[model samples]
Target chain A: MSELLKNTIRFILFILVQVFILFKMPPLHRFITPYLYYLFILWLPFSLSRAGLTVVGFIFGLSLDYFSKTPGLHAAACTLIAYVRPFVIGLLISQEGADKNYISPSIVSMGWAPYATYVIVLTFLHHTWLVLLEWMSFGSFLYFLGKVIASTAVSLLLVLLTELLFFRKQKFRTNTI
Target chain B: MRNVFLFIRRHFNFLFFLVLQIVSLSFLFRYNKFHEAAFMNVSTELTGRINEKYNGIEYYFQLKRTNESLVKENIRLRQLLKENYEAPDSNRRLVMDTIRVDSARSILKYNYLEAKVVGNTTALQFNYLTIHRGFAQQVRPNMGVVGPQGIVGTVVNVSENYATVMSLLHRQYKVVVKLKNGAERGAIEWDGLSPLFVTLKDIPKSAKVAKGDTVLTSQTSSLFPANIMVGTVYDIVPDNASNFYTLKVRPATNFFNIEYVYVIDNMQFEEQKRIEDSTRKKVQ
Candidate 1:
């Protein structure tokens, strides 16, 4: 499948899974909500432009917001992460070595350590922005920190599990969109 | 002009990112204000329909619990039926009737419209529930909603066939409540820490309070009828600086498992509001 078709399918699947399954899951804890939909933005092909990335992130988050009844909380967070994803990736992976070759991020392409760092940093940023926006207050700073940490941990775990489960053995095929 | 065009070309991606961020933040502040604009919400037709379709599948799993709650509510209402009680004596009843008739004539102050919960969230700071009833079912904004056990929330937004309720778990949501025993009125608000408890504030130190005391909606509230169950006092939060005592309350309705609710429409709300507004206008 073309990279564009793959991402299109992934977008619809992520929204459906996030809204219909993950959101509907019984609240395991007050502080823990697993957000795996943002993984779509994280896994987009590396060739996409930064502006294109932000637009896709906005729509992705807004689609979830539309279903979850939170108007812009996710949209703001997702856009921030999408805009920052390139910088984080740039910091971890040099332009000449792997950037020219890698089609998209995966556990195999980026290796275990760099991929883990990439997911951790971006997920933490997304969760912090989302939790901060949802909170919109500094009254309960401790509670806010607790929620951010807890949610980020859960989401990071889910992201890693998804990478391991689906993309563990796949080779970096140069399929341009 | 040439330099400006070059500048735009150089930073177009950053400019686009900033614009998108600003739009999202504006939406965050604007619609997150709750009652200001209700268009970008789950109550809209498309989102509501999708939620309803999903809830249709989830409803089956909740059928047994929903049935039990409905049966319990049925028993409670049945017990309140006039036929359940017998009149004492003809002479005493005749005297009592004259005294009670005036108050009873105005008893039809609130009407209820039943609705099913299609979407609800208790984990978020600003939690909301989407119900299946809306303007089509006479469910309007500012109407109080109640579950079978106790108070749920107030309707904040409505569409043609769906409405969104600002859940009691929300940080900004508040309701005036009084101790069932002392009748000292106070406001109940969530601290955004827990879904199981809300904080009751402004009850004077002079008022007698206990951990197990029941809290009920006060007469002063325009949204909810008096005597609706708000919660039960769970703990007393001590404050040395203030004369008022803050009580932690366990809400009677289980927000985590709410399936069905009744949207309460105050029949005289508009008339009462108009009169109050006129009085304020005259005073001013």
Candidate 2:
């Protein structure tokens, strides 16, 4: 299947699972709520423009908001993370990987540590902004601070678990004579 | 002017982010109220259909539990039937051979509309439930919904064939409840920490309250009928700042596993509201 088709399928599946399953997870902790749908944005091929990334993020988050009943909280968070994606990718990937034509961000392509950092940063950014906006007008700063940290940790774990289950190492072409 | 345009061209990404953020935040704030828009609710046609399809596959797994609750409710209802009790000897002397409608009849104030739980969420500070019944099924906003165990929520939005309920787990969701057979009244609100427990606020210090005592819906609320089981008091703490005790409640209905619910149609709700509104207007 084409990369476009594959990513499109991934997008739909993530939205479905996020809305129908993960959203309904019985709260294990008061502050922790798992959110792994942002994996679609994290896994996008590295070549997309910054503008494209932000737009996609908005649409993706809005789609979830449509069903989850939170109008724009997810969308704004996703857009912010998407806006910062390129810089994070540049910071993590080596020069050689940057020069490559199509690098799908994953454990195989970006190595485990860099990929993990990428997911962590993006997930943290997404959850922090999401919780802040969701609890807008609340007086308890410490409580929301705890919420941001706890939700980020839970989401990070979910992202890593998905990586373990689904991501396979891609064969990178070595430099030849 | 040239420098300004150059700066704008240089930082276009930031500009894009700002625009999108404004758009989304507008949506976030605009429809935050209860009945503003249908687009964000699960009651909308497309989302409702999708949720229904998903719930169809998930419903079977919950059949045993649902059946058990139904059977228990049936037994309870059967015991309340007039035929189950014999007339007293003193009353029997005054009783006529003709069947008395008022004496024999068990008046049912709230009619139940059985609905399948299609979509639900409990992880957020504000959570909602989407059920299969809606405007088409006479399920309207403010209708009380109860699971097999206890009170669930009130319907907040309705489409042609689906309704969205402001779940008991939501931070903004509140229900008036009182201790069973006790005069102490309080309101139940989720603490947003655990799904298992909600905090019951406003019970006065003088009111008798104890652990494991049953909490029930108060008659003051128009949404739920009086005396429906809400939960049992798990713990009670006296608030130093106020003259009330905050009782920790273990909700009777397991919100996470809710599969089916019955929406209540209060027959006298409209008349009751009309009278109440008129009274309020006169006072104002």
Most lDDT-accurate candidate: 1
With a 3 Å backbone cut-off (N, CA, C), the pairs that clash in candidate 2 are none
**How closely does chain A match the true chain A in each prediction, as TM-score?**
0.92, 0.92
Q: Best candidate, DockQ-wise?
A: 2
Candidate 2 regions exceeding 4 Å error are A96-100, A168-177, B1-11, B35-38, B41-43, B91-109
Q: What is the TM-score of chain A in candidate 1?
A: 0.92
lDDT of 2: 0.83
TM-scores of the candidates are 0.92, 0.89
Candidate 2, residues A89-110: lDDT per residue as tens digits?
A: 8899854644263457777777
lDDT (tens digit, per residue) of candidate 1 on B62-127: 889889988999999999977778877686563335667677758678888899999887766778
- For each candidate, report its DockQ versus the true two-chain complex: 0.58, 0.69
Error of 1 at A32 (Å): 2.8
- TM-score of each model's chain B: 0.91, 0.87
